[model samples]
Target: MIREIQSQHILQALELGEIESGQGLNQEHGLGRPGDTRWGSHYKTVSNVTALYATIVKVLEKIGSNKIYKDDRVKAITVMSTFESFEFVFMIHLMSEIFGITDKLCQALQKGDQDIVNAMTYVKLTKEGLQQMRDHGWEDFLHLVVCFCVKHDVEVPTMDDMYVPRGRSRRFFAKVSNLHRFRVEMFISVIDLQLQELNSRFDEENTELLICVSCLNPINSFAAFDMQKLLRLAELYPKEFPTNDMTMTALRHELQFYINDVRQDARFGDLKGIHELSMMLVETNKHTTYNLVYLLIRLALILPVATASVERVFSSMTYVKNKLRNSMGDQLLNDNLVTFLERDLFSRVSDDDVLERFQSMKTRRMLL
Candidate 1:
């Protein structure tokens, strides 16, 4: 059914543009293909399935009842048995709600301009929201599941009724109420595990590090720069910034003076990142004045940028050097990769400027 819907949508899109094909509706909002590295894609697939549940159910019913195709009828019956139940619907909604919170965090972190401080905040908020859902959203979610089951003509199990074990070796298993089995054990436990994983990964140390690193941002007239946070950032590296009382006190004073001097200068006012700040300081020959502070800033800047840029380079390489270009020479490949990676910077260069630089690279026989 999903394949049919997607194929029909694609054909319509090819015949008419997406908007016109769906009569101004979301024509391209068909099924999604989820992959291992893409949590957002999985979430989108689940959401689209939920959105098209009625159509899916109708298709499944038609296939299950069709005596003409025995294989299809059997497969459709199995699918209906699995997906057309209250438990499945409940799980679908539950997972969608949970993934919705995480989806935002996933997107925010992927952005190049993403702020560490904001990302930490998002993590905190997601954890809190998951906790709230576990505590307060139980009854409401159950009510929603019940309503959906009623609408679809599926049996809504009595919450207070005893649930029996469905196995061959049912040797007098202890009884559990449906309410406790589904609501407490399944629902609450699932949410608790997710919350635990998030909390463990995004602990206090990580949060503090993000907040400290964010202090170096020089945007809006260096508004994010905090002397205390900068000191904390320095403290994170004891080998670089000594923890001895005398050395720490003098380092604090140096940091204060450095920030004050930079804030007063008009040239530093427009700087956006640690990279730009470092470059400007080098241009003015002031890196030696605040050597320790400069070293810290350089470390903070390079690690994150280098890691992200390297990943991007490798990702783009697959597209740039496919199987067809397997025999591409290393030097030419390197040059092309550099140009592609630095396209933003290259875009600002004029054709004449590029020609001049290329001509100046060597004593060419003739100039263009």
Candidate 2:
């Protein structure tokens, strides 16, 4: 039985059926169901093809000299990606229940509904999103570093000349062809490029991560940046900020730039936290200079920098080994180790209780 669909119903159904596919409409209504009604395949006619070509050309032409997008690539992505960002947004803006009908969308969007306009908001990438973008954006940087190391031009680590273990270190990383690559600093180059392209978005959190990554490079890199992220932050968000915000921004600027640049730019002065903490390193401390400083900086950026804190958490190796090494079989030793390591379980017991258990073991046999 042929069920008749009203002209309005067919328009609405077809409109709802329009699919983006980054292609033209009427190509086929593949996205949504069209209620099994067959129409004269007007969607496939020569006229539809010509209309699509015309529609695309018109949009491309209309892109420039427009206020909303500003015809900028980033802005274009921001605007289109915002609209392309969601279906409800597109449907509300277009008002015709259409999917990929560009003319209808443009027309509906021109007379955009107040409620739809109220709901449709711009979407900027969050800090996490920006970091994910950087992880992807800097693949070229890793390739460049790989190339530089390949040519035996890895950046010098120390001020005084010291021979690099060429066999061990050079073989570890890749190489580059150009002698100019000798001057190239991998970490700073990536940082500078990121600052140049997207400096406007650098919040203190992002800048702090930048500082931590800069420290990871073996090279002694002090960047000559045209734009300090701190300066950008000061420009965008002036006046008082929380303690972490100021500290993070200062850390990045100091780490990235040369001594002169840092001294000149650090209006608040060198981060005294590092200096103050170093004073606590007494002669009795077993950790080396490198080890001590590593602990301090790692502690500062614990949340953003890494999972290094979780690594230092073995509380049971000494207790388990001493308690069970002689008396227990290997399987029992494993069980004892796990029990000792579960600090929360041990925590529930008193210190006196542990001493009593050890004393009983001592009475039975020599303590393991």
Candidate 3:
């Protein structure tokens, strides 16, 4: 049905000279099946539905009226009625907008070399955008929805009228205006739920920890350095900081000198990330001089990178230990996973080198 529509539209455009003879429309208008684990897929699915709304409606209408299987015909008619409603159109646009706001953050988090500081910044910006949309965007958003409904021939409810439950008894439900029903119940409620989920995932303690970790970033001549935040960060790790006054004071003193020396030294002036800064410190033997500060830097590097690495490991395990190899022993499984996950390093080893190492490890009766 989509292809038929595309062909007709292309022919019409060609006749009208709106498009060149060799030009063609995009072929990605088909609906997508969203996955449970990735919200980015959901965004793509919703965006496709929005773009192909008219095509979908035409197909459904034709399917409903045509001589088709009874079950499919009945389902098409039911869906067509639902799709033509104001509520459905409104919800579709609303979810499309919400998912559009979050798609960038989702893509960033999926990257292997994602900058933690920049990722956190994206989270902050996403939250602020959602909040701003909730506060001042209802009128404009509703106007856009109204325009879409008008164009698509979907019914637009009168906001000033009292809203009634669609399938329930009027006597059983409380009175509310359509404005409240949409703006408060649907729009605000969905945005609040998203905000709540984000907040729960990145709560105060975790966000503060990431922010403190960003302070150790050596970019722009150690511009993000914050002694107080770093001290608080060290305190979070009680096992390392020891929960003693002396340890805290020594950390504070070390941080003072550490920042001063690193900032003034030309060797450390053009450093990039926390990892390079760590290597430079160790190479220059400053790790021993500012042992406490180096410990904090190590902690900062370990937390976020360790988490991403663990997630990668678990993801890689699915490919290494499949159903056919489900009964593989722990040691062999670990060996296989190490080679698979570190394939870039393993790729440098030759087949002869592996055979030589294997032969040297054990005496074999059959030689290659």
lDDT, candidate 2, 255-308, per-residue tens? 344334334533314333332223333332412433423343344334332232
Estimated TM-score per prediction?
0.78, 0.17, 0.82
RMSD of 3: 3.6
Residue-level error in angstroms, candidate 2, position 156: 55
lDDT of 1 by residue, 129-242 (tens): 899999899988888888877877778888899875433354675568888878887899999999989889778886787788888777777788888888888888898878
lDDT of 2 at 251: 45
Q: How good is model 2 by TM-score?
A: 0.17
Q: Please, what are the lDDT tens digits per residue for candidate 3 over residues 1-368?
A: 87798677667867898877743554546677997666899998898888888888988888888886566899998899889988888999999999989888888877766666788888998999899999999989999999999988888989999997765698986799998998899999999999999999888888888888889988898988999999999989999899899999999999999999999999998887888999999999999999998998898877755455677788789999999999999999999999999999999999999998988897999875
Q: In model 1, where do residues sit more than 4 Å from their true spots?
A: 1-28, 64-74, 164-175, 302-368
Could you tell which candidate, 1 or 2, scores higher by lDDT? 1
Error of 3 at 253 (Å): 3.6
Order of models, best TM-score first: 3, 1, 2
